[model samples]
Target chain A: MILLSLLGISILVALIMAFIGDWRFAPEVNIGGSLLTFIVSLVLALQVYHEGGSISGSTYFFVDYLNISLVVLTTLVSTTTAVFSRRYMRVEREHGRVGHWRMRFYHAMFQLFIFAMLIALVTNNFGVLWISMELATLATVLLVSLYRTPTAIEAAWKYFILCGVGIAQALFGTVLLYFAAERVLGAGGNALLWTNLSRVCAQLDPTVMRLAFVFLMVGYGTKAGLVPLHNWLPDAHSEGPTPVSAVLSGLLLNIALYALIRCKALVDGSLGSGFAGNIMMGFGLFSLLTAAFSMLRQKDIKRLFAYSSIEHMGIATFAFGLGGPIATFGGVLHMIVHSLAKSATFFSVGHAAQMHGTQEMAHIRGLIRGNPAVGWGMFLGVMALAGMPPFGIFTSEFLILTATMKDAPYLAPLLLLGLTVAFAALFRKVQPMVAGLIPSGQKQLSAANIPVFLHLALVLILGIYLPGFLANWFHLAVEILK
Target chain B: MAHTLAAQINSLLAALILLSAFALLAQRKIMGLVHIFAWQGFFLALSTAVIGFASGEHHLYISSLLTLGMKVFLLPYILYSLVHKLKIHRDIEAVVNIPTTMLLGIVLVVFSYHLTAPIRELSNLMTRSTLAVALATVMLGLLMMVTRRHAVTQILGFLAMENGLFFAATSATYGMPMVVELGVALDLLIAAFIFGIFFFHINTTFDSLDVDQMAKLKETD
Candidate 1:
């Protein structure tokens, strides 16, 4: 019942938003839809907790401890971002940056994007997963170009072409996966179902499985913002509206990693050689180091956080690659905390950008003096992102570090270096902006600080004390992964 | 005898598909690139039909029809109207010289063959031999994207790559599940519509379709 509601509400909301999206109350409708979805997801979490295993709602949808938590996280962040977009986009209209048509388009596409993500998360079919991921991309490409500026168009174009080509490779990989499964499952739709494949994965051809995993890694890794294919990540995140950036950083990257990790489990089962895990670790560590260093050079505040997203995803990916109970636990925790903190930072950054009328960090001055609410919000959010103590990120990062030290002792120093560099880079840019002299005649916008503080408060609570149920949830998910 | 005949027709279609991928890489006129892409789609449909007949999988026939309609008729029409409306009839310049691009294409073909050797050795399917050609076509399409400068040509390269993947699906496993094939076809249609919208947006914003002009988004000092 919860599964059907989750899908029904998203589709119904998308349709309703498409028709009435230009109206003044459209933002409220968007918020209502997201809130309803969040509530439904919480119900899903409760059901999964009570059930204590995977639930096959049908042949089409599957829910387990792993995705139930992610579903709740996705809907929660989306709801908060919806609220933030209400205030932020209104200010944008006053500046004549977006008119009614674009606003309608934005609202409709936001719901569709969420729908695509929800489908991607719950679908039992790998083919459906691929299609929904592409749907998410198509829905967001126009959103990225919403301002219709030259640079916005360029960013959207680059995002479309790069992700288009990269995702095509993933289709090929999916084809390869089906090819390997066809023999074992006797050539039909049953071959593409994840549940069936996992049960019989050992009987699947290892050579074909290995090739398929490599293609799946590159294809999904591109979406996950891994290095070498990560050029589109910063441009898409920075150029889009701040709410889009929030979800792109906080939620979309996790979905891409989720797809990759799901496929890795099958490959690991078939090969029994840790081949998939090693490849993930290599890409993970490389992305971590590269993005950490890249963060220092960013002039745009959103881009700085965008690169930090890549760094954190790299850490999660690396943790999952370690392929043991401890590291996988750390990885899952990192995903949750990073999503909360990063989206909160984008919320603060969005309001800060509006106040100063720029995204360039150099021109903005004295955030605290200008508006204390937004300033302190930005400070705490960035601190959380930088993995400082007393924040949830610190706990997750600490767990990952210890896991790395115990398992891959040689790689610990490199991880420490990346984390340190990212820490310094964030503080150096963020401190002055928060504390320096207030620029004269800076008009304070009525900012939305609730979402920002709400997210941070949750992160703080998780940092100090993780409840037993959530811990049990993570442990169960890790078992499923192994 | 019927099985051998079907395999023969399949290989011939595969060879034609690969030739068009090469043609796409070497074609300079935007109109010519679109024509080559259409021909590539036709050959892919033909190959899918032949594979279906040989394997007795009725779903491949539907996939073939979908490909023919979307790739051969609808997508090309969209591309044609876009080219005509945009009035970009100028010859496209390759980033690398044509000869160098062709040499690279040849190298990629060889690499694909080597990559698929193990699979060919293990599989017993009639379409197994064409697997290398499918992979080669994919790589060639990627090469086309890299070498071409025009936005239209890059899109053509992308479409050609999708054709290659479809061919791979048909040749490797006869076809994916009917539902997946339909979903993929729908995605292709949506993607084409989006690409069309973007072309106008790109043209209006930058006043040109040269992807090179879109360099304002890099990092700063």
Candidate 2:
């Protein structure tokens, strides 16, 4: 409860500070507040360990392994990114790319974005969750169009219309789920509660549950940036502020997946595994293959990373869909690793964009020669993203491949093929910028953010050594998934 | 006797909704399109109000009032003013010529009735046949959007589509909660204002209200 309070209040405090109207200290205040919140959450995690399993709420909140794990990821990344954006945004201001009021607007929207994500994660009610996700989408839409150029506006408009329709579908699907549960539970509002639904999931009609999953997946999948529906992701990422791209890929995508996984649990639990798994596997493979090939032709830097995010999400979905302890655990680890690595990649990409004056690969060259910290950091981030050995993605991907190979031998080949295709595609785009001769741009002050570096380091360390306690928690969480 | 009265009223309202969809499709003048759209909204509000009274759900009553105020009264008024302000009384450049659009609109009505057949079976007894009518209104509204190139015509189509959705809710479930209805009503009104301003901007930029001109704004190598 203390951790939850801190996590929730950090956003409030950040919101308060952003409105303080002193541009310099507002971001600092936000960062410091989130850091304090992080420390508090860490303490609460330790206490949870001491008590051993389950500390739920009276109403509208829960702290089971599933959400508690997600909260930790969300808050930790959010705090780090807040600290990172202070430096990142200040650099932009110094460069004259953005103005003071716009800075305030950015800070305000940033805090609100975090607040929305927290609400979506913690809210037990499906209606509240739907509303929170809408809030998040709206906040990010504003951020995506911050530049207000024709292209940015076009991107934001496309995002708004498509996602508006998608969220409406989710809304109708949610109403249907309520209708499905209402008859069984004799509903007031308990029919709409996640915990309550999970508890009585077995009693619900399988046919209704199965149909609901289709709506939930297609609806949430649009937000998750799954290809065919992923048209918005690359554009939004390419066009938006970089910190937002980081959060969208790292946090927002995960949030959508988390929602789907919750829905998947309901469907899987009710109808048995095979029915849901078949569709999940199909969508996952389709997304992975599409992203793999899509990355091959990409020239825009942020867009390249956007496709990689999709590929990783596909891997995570494939893992959970494969349905085993090892696979589910692997999926969770991949979620965490990819979040950290990809955020770091964006941080570097943000810096590289600042340095190069353009997002085009043709315009950027020899990042290492230009600024070793950001250059090497981007290279390392790319290496990690491409699932290189001795990185967290590698461990997670390996676990997934191994688990699939052992259980569903047919899926293993597809997984391997997709992985190889992704690796090649990423490297093909990555090599030119990271290794070539420096193009024409003045070398700027390199403050490749310390938090981003810290994130990369933590991922590298975890790849080499999964902390015993964290592993235990993931395993326990996987058990909960089952 | 009461059930028969309720069924007759619902069937009448549904018929009005379907007829307006046809009128919207066949209407040539943009001003006529706006008028037909307002008429559709009027039918929707009437149907929902009737459903609310029949069902005894007070929220449905509140929703019907909102549907009336926004969709029928305020929205049409705004569109009329926008039409006048933009001096856009000329016939909209229909994406398909009028006769073909009407033919297609008829096809959509038939298709909608087919689509709503199963739904009609499990529907509220009073609203049984209205399901097909509501679906037909929805398809006709969609047809209005598709075959119209003018921004004002497209807005008419969108509003008409909402009228269909409102009618569907009434026919299927007696209506969505009052709060949701009000929220959507507010959203529609606000959207109309925003889109109207956008239309004005588009007109000034391109010197035409036709969306085909905006295609030139799209990316080209």
**How high is the lDDT of residue A472 in model 1?**
89
Name the best candidate (by TM-score).
Answer: 1
Tens-digit lDDT track of model 2 for A132-192: 7767887787678676555665566557555755665465456546645765775344666
Task: Find the 10 residues in a row with the least total lDDT in model 2 chain A.
Answer: A167-176
Model 1, span B1-221: residue lDDT tens = 98999999999999999999998888888888889899999999988998888889888889999999999999999999998899886556545588889999999999999988888887799999999999899888888887776889889999999999999888888888998989988888889989999889989888888899999998776
Instruction: Please report the candidate that would top DockQ against the real structure.
Output: 1
Evaluated on CA atoms against the true complex, candidate 1 attains a DockQ of 0.87
| Candidate 2 per-residue lDDT over residues B1-221, each given as its tens digit | 76678678878878888888888877778888888888878877887777777767667777778878887888889988888898887655545577887888888778767755654553335776776676567567667765777767776776676677667656655654444455456556545655675566557666777765543223211
